[model samples]
Target: MAFTCTIPAVATLQQDDEAIRITRWDFEPGAVTGWHSHGWPYFVVMLVDGTLRIHDGEKATDVPLVQGQAYMRQAGIQHDVMNGSPHPIAFIEIEVKQPAALKQLAA
Candidate 1:
């Protein structure tokens, strides 16, 4: 997917160690995170209630989120995310570096 988004979202890296990587993403209304793919599985925790316009390769979809809401996606998800809400939005993204090991620990 091609994104002509001139206003890009801001990503603040909180941590990056052997086991995990953490980042906080903040976006103004109409801001976007240009098309990219994740190298590891990740979880998103919403800090502000808002809607995100997700652009998959083929089409765009709106995902409504509530404050404190959380969701996870696997690696290699190629997509673009835009702040669909009229206000600013922020979310914390925790990317698991060793998903297999984490799963083993849960077993």
Candidate 2:
């Protein structure tokens, strides 16, 4: 299924030579990120309290977000995230890129 809502990247807070990228995403009601995969480990910090539906191809899960709450995930996760609330929602995502060998060594 294709997502048609307009989910925009409201801001790019930072990007460094060390391969770190920080971006802020704003989602209006019913907006979605569409299908995407992360190539590096990343973390998300919730800027507004809201609910999101995570669709992983076959199933969908609703996740509640609290303002100031944060979560981390390793690379290779693919999903389409959609705002499940009537109000606007926003969050900051920080991506950390590391050498594959270093990532394997740390595992």
Candidate 3:
């Protein structure tokens, strides 16, 4: 489904050892992140409960995440994350980073 992104609250949770970076973002129902690409391998931990649909090119996945559940993702992936449920969704996005030089090059 087509959507427009609504600005949401974003906060950096942590960044450690060039191995991982975590951030939290909040979204209301019908909110979308628009098309974007992940720079590093990552994972997401569902914070506030909600349903989300992640679409990537020709494929799509409906993932229902509860508080504390986690999902892993990879770099170079382009996708749109949407909050399809009625309640707002809050989650922590963790990016697994490469070495300094590698990450700088990717950046």
- Root-mean-square deviation of each candidate, in angstroms? 1.9, 3.9, 6.0
Q: Is candidate 1 or candidate 3 better by TM-score?
A: 1
Q: lDDT: which candidate is best? A: 1
Residues 25-106 of candidate 3: C-alpha lDDT, one tens digit per residue:
7787777777778989888888877888777766667788789999887688888888877888888887878645344443
lDDT-wise, the better of 1 and 3 is: 1
> For each candidate, what is the lDDT?
0.92, 0.81, 0.74
Error of 2 at 44 (Å): 0.3
Model 2 off-target regions past 4 Å?
1-13, 99-107
Q: Per-residue error at 62 for model 1, in Å?
A: 0.6
Relative to the unseen true structure, what is the C-alpha lDDT of residue 2 in candidate 2, on a scale of 0 to 100? 39
Which is the better candidate, 2 or 3, if ranked by TM-score? 2
The model with the greater lDDT, 2 or 3, is 2
**lDDT (0-100) at residue 6 of candidate 3?**
63
Residue pairs in candidate 2 whose N, alpha carbon or C atoms collide under 3 angstroms: none
* TM-score per model over all chains: 0.91, 0.80, 0.73
Q: For this target, which candidate reaches the highest TM-score against the unseen true structure?
A: 1
Q: Total clashing residue pairs per candidate?
A: 0, 0, 0
Model 1 per-residue lDDT tens digits across residues 1-107: 65567799999999998789999999999999999989999999999899999998788899999999999999989999999999999999999998655654444
